[model samples]
Target: MTAVQQPLAPHEREMIRDELLRSLTKLERSLKSSGAAARPRDLEQDTVGRLSRVEALQNAGFTKNLEAREKAQLEQILSALRRLEDGSYGACNGCGAPIPFERLQIFPETLACGTCARG
Candidate 1:
């Protein structure tokens, strides 16, 4: 038996889109505040001890990795927004099935239905 999928209501879609926009804005602000991409590690500073320098470098690397992940998520959210604009937001990209509104609520940037996602 196939599960029937319902299209998201306009109100539901609007809510999700608003949430995505808020998330995107928050992430952009976070990325800007971190300045991970432009930050330079000054290893030669006389006031810094060797262990402190190593720890600082490690932290910087971790911060950069987090920034990259956040940027990727932002891109996904943007893509989902585009899909909404194109009237394809609630449809699975894999099997061309409609995605459930509840699932979309839990994962606003999903591109596929649960079955296609599992496969």
Candidate 2:
């Protein structure tokens, strides 16, 4: 039989919520500043040398990838916040198990517990 797990304490929930909010704010600012770097640049031969153009293209690609990752993380944070509001924040979505407080402390946006996440 599976054991029942206790829900998160109010203070613990508040702490995690605060951390998630802080992360959301930081990521939003980062995404805003990185928007220009991810844009396509003018790669005309006369405008920029071949090597410079290649470097610019590579940099843009890197920036785009970074922004994509940040955007995904932002979404995860938002989802976690919603779960918090709905009284489901620390519960694993897969099996309805309580995610360990230690794990939540490290990954406040996670939706699954370690076992379910690995599977």
Candidate 3:
């Protein structure tokens, strides 16, 4: 069953907006970071060095993937911002109807209301 929604206070909406902005900024920085390695050295410490480099590369890859996902979500949030500017933020994208304030609170970047989104 759908829960009743309470409209966001100005402070709450501001907090979510700030969070989205921070995430976007972090993602942008992550995308610009120098990558894991330049060249693998063929020195005597090859085993340990290569292992450590491989681990670092794996971690960087995971971080990059996560940042990309966050970036996409932030883009969706920015889209919501555009909708807000146009005075259409709370309306469902699929149908001409209001989106529940609760849904928006939980997922401010959502474009579709629960009903339309389910489909």
Which candidate has the top score in lDDT? 2
Alpha-carbon shift of residue 68 in model 3 (angstroms): 0.8
Candidate 3 lDDT over residue span 1-119, tens digit each = 12213335667567656765676677566655523322233445645677786776676677667756766775786786666555566667677576776787777778788999999
**Which residue window of length 10 is worst by lDDT in model 2?**
1-10
Find the number of clashing residue pairs for candidate 3: 0
* Cα distance off (Å), candidate 1, residue 58: 0.5
**Higher-TM-score candidate among 2 and 3?**
2
Off by over 4 Å in 2: 1-5
lDDT of each: 0.84, 0.88, 0.64
* Root-mean-square deviation of candidate 3: 6.3
Quote the lDDT for 49 in model 2: 94
Comparing 2 and 3 by lDDT, which wins?
Answer: 2
Model 3, C-alpha of 61: deviation from truth (Å):
0.9
- Residue-by-residue lDDT tens digits, candidate 1, 6-112: 55777998999998899899999999977855498677879899899988888888888888898899899999888888777888878988988888888999989
Ranking by lDDT: 2, 1, 3
lDDT of 2: 0.88
| Tens digit of per-residue lDDT, candidate 2, span 1-119 | 23226778889989999999999999999999999778777688887998898889889889999999999999999998988887767888789899998999999999889999999
Worst 10 residues of 3 by lDDT: 34-43
Deviation (Å) of 26 in candidate 3? 7.3
